[model samples]
Target: MLVDLHSHTIFSDGRSTHAEMVEAAIAKGIGIYGIADHLCFHDNPWTTRLDQFEEMRSTFANLKANTTSAKILFGMEVDYVRGCENRVLRLKEENHWDYIIGSVHYIGDWNIDSNAADWEGKDVDATYTKYLELLEEMVDTKLYNIVAHLDLPKKYGHFTDIDFTDRYRAIGEKILANNMAFEMNTAGRIKICNEFYPRRDIVELYHQLGVDVTLGSDAHHRNNVGQFFDEAVALLKEVGYSRICYFEEGQKRYLPL
Candidate 1:
């Protein structure tokens, strides 16, 4: 069963409408497909506006009722900002989403993945450390079901000389403690990094830590729905993961890979 829990539509930065993305997912044989568009408190070009929630909820309701080929989920990739907990919580409460994916794309107003210029002559190690620290804090909030793109700092192919094995393990521990899962986002393969999010070694460490995982394409275009899913499943199996997880009515569920 192919369960892709992360995708986008015109609601965010995606290139297609919700209907188009769902049709593509059906064609791709996705068993359970989720459309998790970007949801951030801060105003941004790629995030869905707070005012559009009601319309999106209604649209999802209609899609769930009409779509029969695959199980369509109403999800949101919510950004984890330090002072935006209440806003996120309120959104979750009002929407009653099937799942909420928490992600950290900004570090003190610096959009880490925006461009390589953000890393100019700065302390790469400190930035990496800060990202992990924020990741841990996001998990600690216990407000999210899955963490999107575990190692986002590598999106621009940036690497830190300092070893972060312990840090990765610590994040895994926190996810386990909070009963949250991290997604093996495949979008990274097309990014400058040319690798999957949460590198192979990190996946192996998570497996060792007994942390759960889910699959996400992070697709912004209709054609990319369930993109690279076969490779992702193969990698998970190689890392000793026999099953992958998803959520239903805000409850976590699993399916064999």
Candidate 2:
């Protein structure tokens, strides 16, 4: 049974509605599906608001109540912006979400998108350093169940000139210390990079550090649901990960890949 823990819907930047995403998951034979829409952040114009969150939550609950074939877990893909702990805490307190995935989509003042050429001639190492710093801060919040996609800057080719192994190892140690699972987001294969987020080497390092892993498609559309999931499982297996993590009632459990 395969479980995809990261996905989005029309409530945020995704192209499809929540029901459509769930139906697509069913078609893929997924045993579990998590609806993680983008969390509201100060810089991003596309962030979800409180009312939208409640609406999405109610919609998901209603959908889950009517279904029995596939388990649907409600979640949010929170942006790891500076000083985002207060918002996270409030959301967790008010909602009964099954999981929360903290992700870093921006570094300092720069946003990561499909445009890699825009970052030309910039200091790659400094940018990564700032990003890692934010990652460490986010992990310290202890508000997220999983870290969405480590080394996401690679998506924009920012990490090409930087050796992020040692730095990532340090970050991995912190993530392990916090007992938070790192996600292997398969959406990258279809993104500008045409590769998995964090790449394989970073995943291997996380495994070496004894950190647990979760798999996500980071799907923004129905067709993108569970994209490249089989390959993600194969990668995890190659890295010695026997199972993938799932969250329920603010706790995590492992499921076989």
Q: Give the alpha-carbon lDDT of every model.
A: 0.91, 0.83
Q: Give the number of the best model, judged by lDDT.
A: 1
TM-score of each: 0.97, 0.94
Cα lDDT tens digits for candidate 1, 129-191: 999999888988899999989889888888888889998898899988988899999999999
Candidate 1 clashes: the total is 0
Give every collision pair in model 2.
Answer: none
Candidates' RMSD to native: 1.0, 1.6
Q: Name the candidate that leads on TM-score.
A: 1
Task: After superposing candidate 1 on the true structure, give the runs of residues whose Cα lies further than 4 Å from its correct spot.
Answer: none
**Which pairs of residues have clashing backbones in candidate 1?**
none
Error of 2 at 198 (Å): 1.6
